[model samples]
Target: MNHDRSNRVCPVENAGGLDNGIRKFLQNPRKILSPYVKAGMTVLDVGCGPGVFSIEMARMVGTSGRVIAADLQDGMLEIVKRKIKGTEAEKIVGIHKCLSDRIGVTDKVDFALAFYMVHEVPDQASFFKELHEILKPNGSLLIVEPKVHVSRSGFEEMLKLVRSLHFEVAERPKVFFSRVAMLRRLA
Candidate 1:
């Protein structure tokens, strides 16, 4: 785990470093992702440091939905709190701090996000296996990483192993596309 950084937080508010202005730049993803996420659905943001993505997704999913923003850091969750200020977001977001491979979330999530996080894991297979089991059937997992951090070939190899567990890349949206490959849970 070369992800050496301070990891402490509480998800009582918005986390910055990903403000709403920058978040607006992510509008395209919301359009592409709306079909997979719906009101009343449960969503999980894995490695949800600072919880920017979770806050955004909370707005998109509406009041009836739930968002579990799990991270190994509580300070990041506090950052998320400062970002969203006062809004409907305060209630929709839940925070969990855990470093275990099986994220201690009880919700049957319709979607899971591993934004800029998978590469930092000390155990990739164990992480994915746990994610695979937690997802509801027809759920989806999207992973985003810096294109500079890992070679494209190395990423593809890891993705291949995940595919064996029944995940298939539904979209490959270029490096600029958050350097991510969105995978749909098929099994």
Candidate 2:
């Protein structure tokens, strides 16, 4: 968890402040998405804010799989990019700037995560559709949105959206101040 707090556009505490050990403690993301992620599976971290979990995911996917760290802010992405630049791990990770909620994930990725950032999205329906399209067969999309700042109705709306797309709620972790919405694309 390496991050510089200089960029404060979101007012949300830097997502990368949780230390390495602490990150391991929160590795329950696997439990949330479960068997979908293995040692060699391509992953997408949408709205990767500052690459906190993206770093952890790189370790999970190991040397075989690739993790694409994407966000709308180049400033924040640059911070995370520099934090992990020039290393063996760099080969397994990539960064991108996409604001259209298009996702841009290819058929290779097995997992996608939007950690505590989905509700802030300008259009939930559009984002969910894009996620459903990019994921491979049976691919998983784990959405963790703040239950406090975000509306309950919106979460329900997403639930409906995912279900309509044939995605099921695979798991839901008990996240503090937030609710985890894990959905899996039908195989």
Candidate 3:
């Protein structure tokens, strides 16, 4: 399916959904990521939006680790910055503004979360390639897309693109109302 970057959801709407009380209950960051995340493990929260998961992941990573919260909209990053201010999570979480075609993350990460945002990317191939480059050896990436928004065929197409970059499917976790996949870089 062809998508225009301009058609991406606005930052304001994204913030509402990301931090909604019911949504958090349905998509608890801790429960969804506990198996893969550990203390002192550097993580990347791709398409971090208002930092709901970023803050939770920052707490999980503790002071020794870092969470890079990247989003294409400055407004979204600003919301993340505001949400984390005056909290312990602020110390570990870094807000980054990324471009449409490049993530521009320099640090290698142990884990990356691309939650409900991959379908919005204008260039999936380049995005996955860059992600592959920054992942540490044995690192994992978890991708979750809303089943309501993404059809099975479209999600399968994305999996094909990920495999083309030599990423191996490690697991398919069940997420409420979402299609989830855990992938590792092929050594």
Candidate 4:
């Protein structure tokens, strides 16, 4: 399906649905992220919706690490802000506002996650390129797109673009209902 980036961006009104008990059961942030995220490792959650993954990622990364919950919508970031307040995660997770076509984070991260959100990018190649630049050398990027919205061919097309930009396929880990691609930045 041809999707305009703006239309594909999840509206903040529906942000409540993005994080809930069922999603936790299916996506299980820790299980999907544990292998790549380590204590004191800085990570980025690109398009983090309501911080479902960000909060848990903070716990995984511990006090020394940082989880940047980057999103385009201020309301969504506000939701994350509220969720982390007065919690240990508040110290570890930082909410960042992104532009339509840019993540805009200056810090190099040990790992990055684009969960159910890459297809919404207006320019996939540029998106991957920026992701490549922001990642530390040999850093890992885990991209999980919803299978229902992204076709197999479309996902492969993205992979081709990602590889062309100096990212190698690290592994394809299984997530309940997602097309998963784990990539490593080539030094």
| Top-lDDT structure, candidate number | 4
Tens-digit lDDT string for candidate 2 (1-187): 1011121235325645533556446545545444556778899988887777777788789899888888877777786788788876698888877765466665457889888667556666677778877788888887777655556675776687678867899787576567677788985
TM-score of each: 0.81, 0.80, 0.95, 0.96
* Model 3 TM-score relative to the real fold: 0.95
Best of the two (2, 3) by TM-score: 3
Give the Å shift of residue 46 in candidate 2.
Answer: 0.3
Q: Rank the candidates by TM-score, best first.
A: 4, 3, 1, 2
Worst lDDT window (10 residues) for model 3? 1-10
lDDT of 4 at 161: 83
Tens digits of per-residue lDDT, candidate 3, 47-103, equal: 998888999999899999999999998889989998889999989998888988899
Q: What is the lDDT of candidate 4?
A: 0.90
Q: Taking the tens digit of each residue's C-alpha lDDT, what string does model 1 give over 108-152? A: 789998877777677778788888888999889888776656566
Residue-level error in angstroms, candidate 3, position 26: 0.8
For model 2, the superposed segments whose C-alpha errors exceed 4 Å read 1-36
Candidate 2 lDDT score at position 21 = 57
Could you say which candidate leads in TM-score? 4
The alpha-carbon root-mean-square deviation between model 1 and the true structure, to one decimal in Å, is: 4.3
